[model samples]
Target: MTTPRTRMPAAARRTSILVAAAEVFGQRGYAAATTDAIAQLAGISQAYVIRSFGSKEALFIATAEHVLDLVTDAFRTAIAEADDTRRIEPLLGAAYVRLAADRGALVTLLHLFTLGQDPRIGPIARAGFLRILAILREEAGLSMERATAFLGNGMLVSTILGLQLPAESEDPATAELLEATFRENTPLVRELFGGRDLDG
Candidate 1:
């Protein structure tokens, strides 16, 4: 007997659409991502995506903001759960390494950064970037230099992730960069790559 697929709840379905949109936009960039592909990936109708998000521009904005929310939320969780004795930086790094498994979100941030000249997206992107920086300073209680270094390290991780080099530990340079970039989070990176390790 063929099994029936259960319908996704409204919130879940919307989250799925946003996720699919992020992946499509990350892969194709904002200009080329289409509602049809996003719908297909989301297992929903294109009409639903449009009805929900209004337009491609609106969808892009929502997706970009959603990605920002995920990053900030992860950071908040790390801060909350961090041990008072140890530095929160490593916990935050581990949290980020865990989140970095979402290549779509990682790459979407990069694509978002390139739209600095865009009238609509430019402000959103800049604001989101600063928002993270601000959180590191005001909420996370990191000094100016530590916060800057944390964000810089995150960008480096993003760059390595966007390059897709961490998929395997085959290339010497790729392995070396992965080791260097992910240093303390090497085990998490290995887990993300499915048992692949720095040994090779």
Candidate 2:
């Protein structure tokens, strides 16, 4: 009988592949990203990538999952640091703006929301959004239905706005406009998230 070759740890392999796939998908979009490019970016053979992920769709799902995880982590951090419900929106909005500045992440996020809506990602996406909603509600002491509507709308609006903008618009005026927009919208988010009014 022939001896089998030693396999790399699954966690390490998957992490490396996902990282590479993220870069490729971020740059090229899901439709344009190739396994060959992902493998090359990962410093591994294409066969390895294929063997590990099985298909382009699977790899894209993994990349999307990674991005969602990052978003969840960011929100958790934002909520934790906030002094009150009113601070939640501004902190999260600030995080979103910072994420938008990341070219790779912004591109990847736009692609995911635009075209990567296959059934494969449906459950994962739902779970992630639900988790976020739960957190927002718990932190703000909102009822279930209200939390769902508020967080869901906030995410959709944020994604749409992020997608409509270019990845690297270098005009200072545009930068100022975006900053102003975020500031103006922060209060709206506070209201949606159940922040108490000062005048109440």
Candidate 3:
């Protein structure tokens, strides 16, 4: 006999669907991912997923918002615990790298960023990107140059993971660049990427 499924509370179920949506959307991106796939991943019916999120676009927006929340919260916590203002960038960088361990969310955020041309998602994506920059500049108290550099480095990390370049590339130049880029967070990067051959 099959065991009966335990009913999850509405909030928990919604969260689960979002998590599953992130994973699916991260892999396939916004246009390609479907409610059916999200529902399958979340172990719910497609109709239920629609009822919960109202639509795929709504779900994508929620997922994108969730991604921003994760990034902002990580930076906020790092900033709060930091003693030296100069160390803000490094602390925030480390915190972001740590969050990358949740690969789905990281990739989902990146994917959402690329949807800036979409009428519905574009505004959300632009606003989210600006919010992160604002936190680095305003909240973290980093200068414009510092904030730009920090964001550049973070984007580099995202590109490295997105292309799986750290694990797949065999070029010495690529490896060297990655090494220099992630020199400060090498261990955390390695740990997050699961001992991948980042050495090329």
Best by lDDT: 3
Candidate 1, residues 118-142: lDDT per residue as tens digits? 9999999999999998878887899
TM-score of model 3 (CA atoms): 0.89
| Candidates ranked by TM-score | 3, 1, 2
Q: What overall lDDT, based on C-alpha atoms, would model 1 receive against the true structure?
A: 0.83
> Of the pair 2 and 3, which is ahead by TM-score?
3
lDDT scores in order: 0.83, 0.66, 0.84
lDDT of 2 by residue, 92-193 (tens): 766665554444555566566665366776666566666767776776556777666556655554653544432222456644544455565533433332
Off by over 4 Å in 2: 1-10, 140-176, 184-200
The model with the greatest TM-score is: 3
Could you tell me every candidate's TM-score relative to the true structure? Answer: 0.87, 0.68, 0.89
Clashes in predicted model 3: 0
What total of clashing residue pairs does each candidate reach? 0, 0, 0
Rank the candidate models, highest lDDT first. 3, 1, 2
Between prediction 1 and prediction 2, which has the larger lDDT?
1
Compute the lDDT for candidate 3: 0.84
Better of 1 and 2 by TM-score: 1
Give the Å shift of residue 195 in candidate 2. Answer: 34
